[model samples]
Target: MKTSFDTFISEFQQTDNPDEKYTLIEQIISSLAIIPYGHKNLTKSEMIAHKVFVILRDYVIINQLRQKHAEDTSSQKVLLNVSLLFMNLCNNINETNITVFKSLFIHKPLIDELANCLHEISTHGKYLNDPSRLRSVSSLLIALQKIRKHNFTALEYSLIAPILFSVTQCLCSSYALDMIKSLERNFIQELDEVQMLFLYAMPLYVKWYWDYCDPEYFVKILRILLNDFTAWFTSCQPESYLQRSSQIDAMIRHLNYFLVRPTEFDSMNIFSEEFYDDYCKLVLHWSSILSSILACSSCTMNVKLAARTSVQILYNLTLHLNVLNFMKTIPSFILMLLKVTDLDHDEVQLNAYRCLGKIMIEADIKTMTKPSKIAAVYIAFLKDTIDDSKKTERFYSLLESLKSKFLSIVFFYD
Candidate 1:
């Protein structure tokens, strides 16, 4: 079986015709898939699998290099098949055979090939319609990521820098849309696999290469995800209907990571007008997410509380970002907060009221021409919450500040 597999690999690799090569490779893969692993303490099957993996890896590497520079569409398709085969073997091959797989070569070239392929698919035009090609590329990267978990090195860490840079570009590119569409064909639309891949992989990149956590990388990754999150936000079925999904959870995890690891990411020059403006946009986008989550009555109180906390955190981070415009732009913002203000959670209520205060002040200034009517509108909106016995004293104080700051001349007799 081992010798026949080796013979099969040789024939598959040596064939000049792409059609025959693909056919031969498919047969080889089929045969390898069904080979029982238990024969003679699994030695025979493991040996055959190991040999097949080595051959697959070598062929994959060779073809990846060819694919890297190949201008001919035929060469590109053949190379793509090699990647697909690599993914198949990686998925089907057992972990025990990995010991044999490790002896073949250094991971750097494979890593480089994987990153370059991703970058290629992202930057090139022809590969856009090829779902098989894109999935094969993503699968190779994910397989590498999995292997790196148990066998890491400085070289591996070094390679991830470029991998992440490419990934960042990949996410930013128009190809990312294709990648998302391809993944959705296979997975759920709401929690897109490609987006989830980046969301998970970027943090892992940070974990491995902490020194690479500069502001440029930070801003690029954040903007890419912010754009994706916005897309998800607009297209997502309301949270009420879908059971808990990764869409919201993924964004929350992303925010949670940044919030917890501030020393790594917080040193951006907030004073720069451009940076500050971009930051405000990012924060406001995040605020929209929180507002959406809060508005969903089906979401658990815990999730709502979490969303409120995230809002509070954003408010704290961007005290200077004109929080009022953020609130106003997000149509659900004020209403979401009002709903939360009467809730039993003190922290959530306080945060909601505080956001309300910002909105009132902004409303007063923005509607200065019609300040009285605007203030009346806001007062009328808050009248129910104020009437609630659960309202905290500080909540009233926040409302009073809203009045003083927005409508000081008009005294409230109550």
Candidate 2:
């Protein structure tokens, strides 16, 4: 009598016949571990294994709508099995630098079903959070990147966020293309107007840690997000949801990087304007983020850094423009930069003073009537700076000019 392994091979050879394909694969997979290798040469039997994996992957998609996979051989259970099976198959094929993954996964269009199968796997939060299972997903994404649109399938990360963010960050490293792919996927909502603009100027804020931790990889991903965000923001459909999303707020948080590394990105390559028109608008947005971020942190060191970075980006960019927004924005810009005093070290205070000086250079005290309460805060800060024993002569000098500007406008109203 022939063994079960022999029966599977006989059935597989008949695979060209559609009627026999499903049954042949089902029989082999149903008893995959049980097949006796008693004295058989397993290495020579790969053709049989490849055929089995291919059929199972296709089965889930063609039958996804089946009411029974929901209960009997549920799509849920089958999906979990497929995710695991695909990973193992890749590993098995990769034992010695083999191209089994490409041949089986990328070359075959139907295999994208694995990405969908993962959507079902993600539904069971308990299972997804399982250490072993989560690692399986990271592994799958990483391997997929080596082939094709693997990164394109990252929408699954958004579907499982809060945890997905934490997990992907945990999995991040120099070689983890999957984590980046997932991040790129999360930024895919370009059609949402507010989401797009905030996205433009966003990575500068929301992505600080990710960008600093691995700049080369992170920047590549960020640029992609920014390009998409900028395109969407410039299209100008004019939706009211602009205030609804934190995109603009998030951009303000990390405005420091742009100032310090202004040369890091080529303007023509990344931003649309050659000068500071949008950079000034960005300053306004960042000031809001810093104020929001500072309210949650009491550390003096942090407050100072946030303030200084805010001032620096605004100060430096404000100097480069020949545009007329200087008078339009100076009063509010100075007020925003003033709040960041706590984060500065000895040098930051000086750098910040220079930023104020740059803005003061273009002042028009005759225009931009800011509110009285807002003007009072600037007066109070200037007076306090003048009184401080630690004040650098240069800083105090810059303060005198700003104090003059503030009082010049305030008394005009008085």
Candidate 3:
């Protein structure tokens, strides 16, 4: 079997005709797809699989490079086949063959090629419209995700930086947003697998390459997702739902990372006038969504979780004075936060109160139009603190502290 596979690979490499090469690759894929890794001929099968992987890796690297510089439509079918072959190999990997598979598939050059292929598909016009592009992307992402399930050395993490950057760039591209919209339109209330895989891959990449990734790119992608969420919330379709709770969770996770790494995110121009305006729009949309969700008596836990995350993101944004200033200008935003403070969820209420405190603490009472509303929210919270018999002593202490902190500002304004 080894000899036969070696001969096949040689024939594949020596072929000058693209058609012949494509046919040869398909044959190889078929042969490797059936290899019984659990059978008694495991050693022979492993040898054959290893040889085939080496050839496929080389083919992917070379063709990906070619596709990068030129619009090679003819190669698309072959690349798709190769990606599917990789996915098959990944699917068959187990503890016994893990080392062998990783050795063959975890090459840095091959990873770079995969990343470049995705980047090209996202940026190039012809590739964007190709019917097989999404499938190819999905296959590649599956294989990459499988490989990434194993632990990597520091050097390997360094090698995968290109992949992370490419994925981020692709996610932030206009093409990705358009593709998501198209999928939503076609599927109507379900996110496509390709979109979900992209979302899944993002946090893993961020986790592995946070130090290397640009904060601006993260912000750009987050803004795109927020806009999508806003649209889903405000769309005319009564049956349309915000089925992207996972997306909201992702946003919250990434925002939490940004908050902890203040040196990396807080010091940047992420809060410039342009970003501030974008965030203002996001907050207004989020406010409206939160108001609607609060009004619904039968809102699901997922929707409420999403609403809480939106407020958490808003609280994180308030760490910057510019955002706080903008929040103060929007009465709907203040009212939404105040309504959130009345929610039963402790974490949600904490974030809401934090947001309100931030916005009002630095607020100019002389220019403020809704100081009365802010005062009312604090007074209501105080009343709740006084009237609730189930409140613990510790809870009362925390509320009393918050009351002192907020009442001082209210009296100063009065």
Total clashing pairs for each candidate: 0, 9, 0
Query: Mind giving the per-residue lDDT tens digits that candidate 2 earns over 138-162?
Result: 3344334333222222443233233
Which portions of model 3 miss their true places by more than 4 Å? 1-106, 126-154, 168-210, 214-264, 332-335, 338-350, 360-414
Q: Give the number of colliding residue pairs in candidate 1.
A: 0
lDDT (Cα, tens digit) per residue for candidate 3, span 1-414: 666677787898787887787678778766755875444444433762556667777765346544644356656666667777667657655556666766776677777776777677557743544545555666766676666555556787777777777777777777656654554431134445455444444444454445556667766776675455435433433222244545434533453334322223344455444456555665665566567667667656765675676677676566556766777888666667776766666667666766766665554424545456556655665666564433333245445435434546655776
Which 10 residues in a row give candidate 1 its minimum summed lDDT? Answer: 180-189
Question: Roughly what TM-score does model 2 have, to 2 decimal places?
Answer: 0.28
What is the alpha-carbon lDDT for the whole of candidate 1? 0.51
Of the two candidates 1 and 2, the one with more favorable TM-score, higher being better, is 1
- Cα-based RMSD of the predictions, in order? 14.1, 18.5, 11.8
Q: What is the lDDT of residue 403 in candidate 1?
A: 41
Top candidate on TM-score is 3
User: Residue 141, candidate 2: how far off, in angstroms?
Assistant: 20
Span of ten consecutive residues with least summed lDDT in model 2: 193-202
- Better candidate number, 1 or 2, judged by lDDT: 1
Q: What is the per-residue lDDT of model 1 for residues 278-342, given as tens digits with 9 covering 90 to 100?
A: 44555555565566566666656657656655556554543433434544666655666566655
What lDDT does each candidate get? 0.51, 0.40, 0.59
| 3 Cα displacement, candidate 3 (Å) | 24
